[model samples]
Target: MVDHMIILLRSISAFVILLIITRFLGKQTLSNMNFHEFVTAVILGAIAANFAFNEKMQVIHLLISLAVFTFTSYLLSIIIVKNRKFRMWTEGTPTILIEGGKILEDNLKKNHLTLDTLNQMLRQKDIFDYSEIEYALLEINGKISVMKKKEYHNVTLKDLKKGSKDLGNFPIELIMDGQLLEGNLKVNNIPPEWVMDKLTARGKQLDDVFYAVKGSNGQLYIDFYNDKITHPIDIE
Candidate 1:
């Protein structure tokens, strides 16, 4: 019972220390989580776990270890923010995965990514066809930033003149994962009958749709569960 109380106290101390240290590190460390931050997190977690469970270890020694790691990480983060060269060396540079609609095979191999994984990431950005991408960069945070060709670019307000329909507004979600958001339709003054009519015109039913939205241009867009891509690129 005495040992259990000591363990409980140690666990609480570890949690409190971790929370304080992480909070001081700032949200960027939590959000972006570059290579250094990732390492720091893993090491911190290991130390905290040991501090919590290893009853034989001295509390002062564990606390010192935590403090040293946190201070070094925090200092390095400051240096990284101020020094561009240091930041590049630590976090690495963005790799161009796709350029001029051409996939960089060598770059993919260097990054240890397969063609299948690249395709899946592209699909997540609603880009099934790589030909539409002018440039695709793999960011340091493991996100792919894509720029589509000029011909395939979305029309912006700058491209339009005065008295145009509201193109500034984003598309409103009407259906998601085959579930209709009736509240959205009611708020937008859209009738359920109108939605059914549009679906019927497209030879689709609610059960068949994976997602549906009302575009800012007053057009109904529907995506079905079955992608129906006859020739899928399956180069794993």
Candidate 2:
């Protein structure tokens, strides 16, 4: 029982410490981590795991290791941002896989990517035909960036000679998850009474709403907590 309690306490402490370190590293450490950042994360996680479960490992030693790794990663991030040559060497340059609607077989071979995998990646970006792509780059993070041919690109308002005013505005959330967003309503010049009246008209109360947004098109979109549809279409 004593051993179990010690393990539990250690696990909780390690979890909290790791959480603080991750938050200090910022959102990019999790969301947009490059190659080195990913490796650092894996190593930190392994150290934290050992601290949590390894009876032989000292908590103070693990903490020191975590601190050292985090500091090194933080220092590298600063260097990467300030030094161009180091950044290029660390992250590497993007490889051009396709240019002028022609696939570069040599680049694909060098990257160890198969034609089937390339096609799969292209399909994910909604491009089925390789001929439609003007340029496709294999990014350093292993994601593909595609540029469609001029003829295949979607027509924009500018292309049709439409002015900025013609483009519609986005919706702003006034309430989310049963909580009133007074700041959003104030930004859009909407009164609380007006929102209340709209909800009442729809046989709903503010507490019954899961989400409520006001679109620039003068539409109040309200989603109820108990909304139901008998025959829902499957998007996937």
Candidate 3:
């Protein structure tokens, strides 16, 4: 029981330390963490786990190790930010895989990307036909950025030479889980009476709504708690 208590306490301590280090490293460490940053995080996690659960390992020694690794990574981040050449060396430049609707086989070979993989990536970007791509770049983080040809690109009102009007902000949630969000309604200038009228028209009360939002198109999108769809297609 004592041993378990020790492990629990150590685990909590390690978690707190790691959380502080992560916050110090900033949000980018999680959001846009490159290859090196990712490896550093993995290593730190392993070290923390070892000291937390493994009684054989000295807690002080592991803490010191974690501190050193985190400090080194933080210092390297600073250097990378200040030095352009260092940044390029650490995080390789984006490679152009496709140009002018033509596949660069040499570049693909260099990146070790197979035609099948390329096609899969293209399909992810909603491009089934490679011929429709104007440019496709393999980013430093291994994600593919694609640009479709003018003909294949999505058309907007501006493309049709139509004057653009303010379409309000994106859907603001006025209600969620049958709870009214008066603050959101006030911020969005949505009156409660307008919401009630809409709900009444659909024969739904506020309590019946599981989720509700005021869309940018000036429409109320409401999902009911009892709502059911027989054939739910999986898009993802």
Candidate 4:
């Protein structure tokens, strides 16, 4: 086996190099690898794969190459962020694949996309047909995001003139795994005698219960192990 210390140092160096390189490449590089970036990434991965264990492939060379790639990506991002024209040239804006129920065939073909794929995505999003879509945009990362006209949107309680109901507060567990929770019982203003009396009246032993959670509505749910069944009980 290789020395654990050397392996750890190499791993740490690899991680640092990856972090620097990733930051330099900008968010777009990780989001969707464009054609040229994709090929460059494949080559980089191939080169880095062998460097992990090869005795000749020094860590310094790995760091240098990674730094160079990272710097190139960082500089490009700065230019793209500062210059609108350059940004538009380097990173194309989102295209409206379908607008007002009409599909833009030209943009679709340009992006090497098909109506079948678009329809598949639409259906996955619960949209039955293209007519139901008001706008469908081909985002920069090549993902299709669809928006439906307000009329076709799902209905809410407000739309039906019936407001939503309130969901009550969180439940508290007063008894769990056959153990009495003194703090919880005290916090909820219930005496220990009340719990003991309730269980005794129901002909159930305190230790017989597997778990129990209490609600603000004054209802106590008790569960027992299936193997320990065959018992008589009574409760309010």
Candidate 5:
């Protein structure tokens, strides 16, 4: 067995050294790491991992290596921050993935993102399809920013310019734990038959659906057989 005591001691040493080095590296290293800085980070991780188990290697050696890496990264970060041209070249700007109600297929390919992958990211922000999205930006941090269609969003009295309903439009639960919701069906002027038809059209089994909700505008959202989910299907 690997020596637990050695691992514990080495881990403690690594943590202390890494903390000091990271502090010296500054906030930009974590928040906005450029290509060269990122490469240096990977090298640092490799160096840290290799020395973390070397019983003969003193912790000071690791600390020294970390210090050098941190100094380089910190210097680069300041250079990038001060120079707009350098920043643009280093981190790159956010790419418009979807523009003017259409998917930029060239941009999508440039970013090596498939339509399915983009849709999955969009759904993370409660956006499901291209039809519902107006603008999509792939940020430098590798995160997606999405803007929904105007009709899909909540319409305040100011937006409508009239007092339509003397109430608030609340998101209603249409299905929970694989059960068809009669209450929400009645609320949305939708029959249970419509729910069954929608699910059938999608070719998704109700039992296979992990989440389903009817949002403010009576838009039905259903997630079918998501492997990432950990919960067992509730078949009531």
Candidate 6:
């Protein structure tokens, strides 16, 4: 009687605590969770389960443990967001699986992904033929992003006309969350002055910008923090 009531109360307390903790740690969906998130979720669940069911265990002890883990994880997430190198180390960078229709055997081995798994993922995207892929990347979330060859792509209205504009390579991110990616600028040989000039021309400062990317058409696309959208759809 008393034991059963205690168990019910413990279960409710655990559930509420879990909900609060998960809300604070919200970032990725279950389908797109990284390794760090996956591990954190598993451990949190185990701790929560013990808290809910283990009548012999001290509630305060379990709570202290949860608090330590949650705080550490939250701190790590903040560090990952601010420090790019740490982020790469913890979450890992995307690997190029296929480039120019050629599968990179070394990359496949590095990721420890078998050819069969690769084929299955590719087929999920309706990409059956390896030769059709111009570029395929294995994202940190274990999903594959593929870019098909021009010939394999669907015929667009642009293709119907002669002397169509040349679509430049993949889009390159310049400023993410108002932080300038110096490495990207250096690697792509994009002049720092160019970014400043673009921002200046629009009468905006770097801090005002939310995100900026170089489009595939070799043009700069910039978005500001203050979108100034009046009567924006309030969905949610």
Top lDDT model:
6
- TM-score comparison, 2 vs 3, better candidate: 2
Q: Write the per-residue lDDT of candidate 5 for residues 1-236, one digit (tens) a residue.
A: 46878887787777676777767776656776668778887988877786677777776877788778777877888887566567779889788898657999999999999988888888888876678766788999888987666656568777678634422244556766566768667966878887888889988777877668876455778876566768879654
Q: How accurate is candidate 3 locally (lDDT)?
A: 0.84
Superposed Cα deviation of residue 113, candidate 3 (Å) = 1.8
lDDT of model 5 at position 6:
81
Q: Candidate 1: global Cα-lDDT? A: 0.86
Q: Write the per-residue lDDT of candidate 6 for residues 1-236, one digit (tens) a residue.
A: 99999999999999999999988887452457777778888888999999999988899999998998888788888898777778889999888999888999999999999999999999999999988988899999989999877667777786788544555376678987787889889999998899999999999999898899998668899999899998889545
List the candidates' TM-scores in order.
0.67, 0.67, 0.66, 0.54, 0.59, 0.81
- Model 3 bad stretches (over 4 Å): 162-236
Q: Residues 18-131, candidate 3, lDDT per residue (tens digit)? A: 999998888878787787799889999999899789999998899889999999999999987766568879998888899878999999999999999999988888889888
After superposition, candidate 1 runs with Cα above 4 Å error? 162-236
Query: How many collisions per candidate?
Result: 0, 0, 0, 0, 0, 0
3 or 6, which is superior by TM-score? 6
By lDDT, rank the candidates, best first. Answer: 6, 1, 2, 3, 5, 4
Summarize candidate 2's per-residue lDDT along 1-236 as a digit string, tens digits.
99999999989998999899998887779777887799889999999999989989887899899999999998999888766568879988778899878999999999999999999999999999988887899999889998776667678777679633321343568877676778778887888898899888988888898888886455789888887877879653
Error of 6 at 157 (Å): 6.3
Query: For model 5, what is the alpha-carbon lDDT of residue 52?
Result: 74
What TM-score would candidate 6 get against the native? 0.81
Better of 2 and 4 by TM-score: 2
Which should have the higher TM-score, number 3 or number 4? 3
Give lDDT per model, in order. Answer: 0.86, 0.84, 0.84, 0.69, 0.74, 0.87
Worst-scoring 10-residue span by lDDT in model 1: 162-171
